[model samples]
Target chain A: DAGITQSPRYKITETGRQVTLMCHQTWSHSYMFWYRQDLGHGLRLIYYSAAADITDKGEVPDGYVVSRSKTENFPLTLESATRSQTSVYFCASSENRLQETQYFGPGTRLLVL
Target chain B: LAKTTQPISMDSYEGQEVNITCSHNNIATNDYITWYQQFPSQGPRFIIQGYKTKVTNEVASLFIPADRKSSTLSLPRVSLSDTAVYYCLVAPPAGYGGSQGNLIFGKGTKLSVKP
Candidate 1:
């Protein structure tokens, strides 16, 4: 499909397990971002990639890892998932800078038991 | 990055105009104010953006005063579907290689539109 999409719309896993959420965009934008939204709160950026192979940490990045091996994909990995890591993860893409409007994916809901 | 503060929630009836204001006292000269609206179980969608004066788009209007210390997002004749969380953010001048904390999203104002 066109635009941005996320895999495993819903997931369930045990603590200390490894989990990966995939995000893909057809626009081939230069900027890709990962944000986690907890209940009753706004989105907090976890990681952002300026381009392929260039990623940086955002507001909450301690337990999450992100890589952009290709321009179309930016995957977030939870090496050792914890109960606090359970949240709705959203992937966003923008053509240019921070002032530009971002296009967001449907989001992946992961639960760590 | 500038810190933004807004109300936690608001209530309005259908066909009434609703405005949600955000304050950013420490906003920089190169920053721009933007707003986003998110429905339940979905990602946020951009509503409008402005630097000064007023900016109007099909979805909403953004009003920024001369001081640029605050901004208001105005929605016209809001309906039940417009009941959602509205986020106000101050975007910094730089991108890419700039400081990663240029954008901060606090708990946004949840506007509930009743019938």
Candidate 2:
């Protein structure tokens, strides 16, 4: 109900299908970020939003897209799901982009079948 | 952002104090060292942060030497529940086309506390 939350905690999709993972934060934080975590590695940033209507690419952002139309929302989209896209996606938010800790959501486990 | 190096894994006994060190030889003056703890199936949670010297909180302690090239995360009286991955990170100021919140999470130290 509060903090950051992600929708469809678990998702299943096939190749070539479009999928969207939703993230919401009640804190109205100024920054939101999307990350994907796969096996044998750490969390890699896919995209980040400094504020509403301002988003930037991170380490990995090829097949993923993100938008921040409102201060409390940032959603990630995959135009065409692929097996390699299957991973635990996490959404994070922070009051400001500088000198602050990023708070994370539980994560959305997507399985591309 | 400076590159960081840390142990791939560690083993410790329950009720023992555990310390995981990270090396960042190229750290900049504007960078701050931070640590995060993550359990399986969950996102990382911030443990402690330090600009230099040492910082402590209810969760853990962060020790940064004067050189700032290295830092250690100290976990006190660890228990089985403390077993998790610990990430060490450094971020430049937001002026460098990067926000402090835009952290780089490298392969963290997987700490296994045995009973």
Candidate 3:
């Protein structure tokens, strides 16, 4: 497809395990972001990359790691998964312009036991 | 960063006009108002954006006053398919290097359009 996609649409893991959610976009947008949607938190940003190799922490970046080696791919890794990390993860991309629109992926549902 | 406040939920009948307003009393000079719509289990989609006055697009219209304290998203003749959670966002000003705007989403107003 032409839009963004996240791999392993559903995942299950145990505590202390390492898991990664993959995000890839065809638009080659310079800005890629990862957000976790929980019951009351709405969408809390985990990490965002302005361009390849430049990533910044967002509101809830604890225990989550992100890297953007390529403009089209930004993978989010949980070093040590916990029960609190279970949420619907969404990946979004946008062009490098102020007030630009962000296109979101279908989201990855992760369940940590 | 500007904080936003909106109603928790609303209901309307099909073929009726719907307007959801957001209050941003502390909006900055360069802040822009934007609205997004999200269906259940789906990502939010951009509907409209405006800096001042009124800006209309195919899906919706955004009205902003001169003081920039608030904005309203108008959906004309909404249908059953228009039932979704509408988010009103206040974007950070430009000149900070085009990064991903940290969208502080308030509890969005869930509009249920009855058929």
Candidate 4:
């Protein structure tokens, strides 16, 4: 079903550069989220969108931005990539905002040098 | 969201059943317990979820106590491929709080299955 897909599965960028990870879902879910996973730290939410044009900050939103111009796509932008930003980024979508199952994308591995 | 605590790591044999337990002593009434499995390079995948009692699916089973303070994810007949980090999360039902749909994840239990 191509449920959820992430682009640029791998990226190598330098510090001070900008990078955007794209996420697209075919389910047309109402909610989408961005998360980054690092070693020894489980997973932290970066940003989330309840609906198109409706976005909110998550636990670790600093230096990151998100936009949901369309329901099917939610992209995460790193304004200034840093070495700490080198982690596996994941995008997920849920049908609802409450107690719904979240389906995840393959993930984007970004390396900040 | 209730804070969850789980083992740092576990080991099991291929034919054994692995039960990973999680404790959320401060869980609220409306909170639901969910589990997710993540491989080395993939995103976490939802495994099973339950509010109370027991919920069974094709892949796994979730057992919750009456108080909802703890949960256990039981996997049957483990294999090498089942080696992954299993996360346990507790969050209130949507719209009840500010971080609705925001799943707060803690360091999960790393399961290692050997032949």
Candidate 5:
């Protein structure tokens, strides 16, 4: 399958534990993004990477960390998870084209107790 | 960041044409409007994109008026399968290198298609 994928599609953790969500894409898209979808907030960008070793903050980057050591992978980590951080996280990739159409992975549903 | 406003939800029956409008009063000149369809428990899929005027693909049609402050997505002959949330996003010009551009996806319009 030549598409984006997220590992640990479903996750559960305690309030103070650390958690990491992995994202990988086969298309070698230069741009990768992480977004959290909550009930009323919709999709808020947490972080994004332009290429390997180049990451930037997004709309809601607090309490989250992201790294792109390789072009195909962008992993997001929660240093200390909180119940407020529980939401569906989506990873997307896109080329630097004029349209910049983003292709999203299935998603990772995180639940913090 | 250019903010977009769309309906909270809409309802339609099968074989009917449905149009969902989104308002982006702060759209920039170089920005582009894109629509994505998201089904429950899944990610969003790009449906269409347009700058101005009308753009149509096999899936749907996007109409951006001359002012570009708003856009409409038209789904023809919608079926039960077309029931999903549609997000209208205003994306800034593609950034180079490390510059981060905004693609704000607000609470999308949930279209409910029934028999």
Candidate 6:
């Protein structure tokens, strides 16, 4: 109840459909991030939010959109899902930048056909 | 932001000390070395962090030399449960914003502890 949570832990969506991955954190951390993990590439950051209403793109942001309306919620949206987008997505939060420890959600496994 | 390099994989017998070294040649003055351990299908959990010299915790120890160009994560008497991917990251100080300011992950060293 007090940690980060991701909704729809497992999802299967058709290509070209829109999908959204939800991330909620109870810690009220200022920094929130979304990362996608694949077998060969490891973990690649997709987006990060510094605070409410401030979000920036990370290493891999194409075809994805992120919005942070409140400190507790940062949602990632895929406008047109592709098969290449299939991966395990992780959401993490930290109180501030620097050496702060990041608490992560369980992760959302998405499969696109 | 500094890029780190580490071994791709390693294996060790159980109850043996395992040391995984990470090299960060361009580490900044304010950067801090941090390590995280991740089991399969789970997000990485913070192991230990250090700025210089040595820092030990209940889980593991972080060793940084005077040059600050590299750091080592030493897990004493590792067991099968300790088998996981260990990531070494160089994090910037607070309020540093940039594309690379975020935690940049490397391939990570996969340590398999066998009994």
Worst 10 residues of 3 chain A by lDDT: A94-103
- Best by the DockQ measure: 1
Clashing pairs in 4: none
How do the residues B18-71 of candidate 1 rate in per-residue lDDT, one tens digit apiece?
A: 999999998989888889999988999888888999999898899999999899
Interface RMSD of each: 1.6, 3.1, 2.8, 2.7, 2.1, 2.0
In candidate 3, the residue pairs with backbone N, CA or C atoms under 3 Å apart (3 or more residues apart, or in different chains) clash, namely none
Candidate order, DockQ descending: 1, 5, 6, 4, 2, 3
Per-residue C-alpha lDDT of model 3 across residues B4-114, encoded as one tens digit per residue? 899989999999999999999988777778888989889888899899999998888888988999999999999999999988877664333443435556568989999
- TM-score each candidate: 0.96, 0.93, 0.93, 0.93, 0.96, 0.94
Q: Which lDDT value does model 3 have at A42?
A: 68
Given candidate 1, what's the lDDT at residue A33? 91
Best first by lDDT, ranked: 5, 1, 6, 4, 2, 3
What is the model-wide C-alpha lDDT for candidate 5?
0.91
Clashing pairs in 1: none
Per-residue lDDT tens digits of candidate 2, residues A6-109? 99899999999999999999998987889898877788878888889888777788998888899999999999999999999999887875446889999999
DockQ of each: 0.69, 0.52, 0.50, 0.56, 0.62, 0.61
Tens digits of per-residue lDDT for model 3, A1-110: 79999988999999999999999999989888898988766677788877899887766889999998999999999999999999999999988853568888999999
Model 2 ranges off by over 4 Å: B95-102
Please give me the DockQ of candidate 4 compared with the native complex: 0.56
CAPRI-wise, candidate 2 is medium
Q: For model 4, how does the per-residue alpha-carbon lDDT over B18-104 read when each residue is reduced to its tens digit? A: 999999988888888889998987888999988999999998999998988899999999999999999987866665227743467
- Each prediction's number of clashing residue pairs: 0, 0, 0, 0, 0, 0
**Regions of model 3 farther than 4 Å from truth:** B93-101
Give the least accurate 10-residue stretch of model 3 chain B, judged by summed lDDT: B93-102
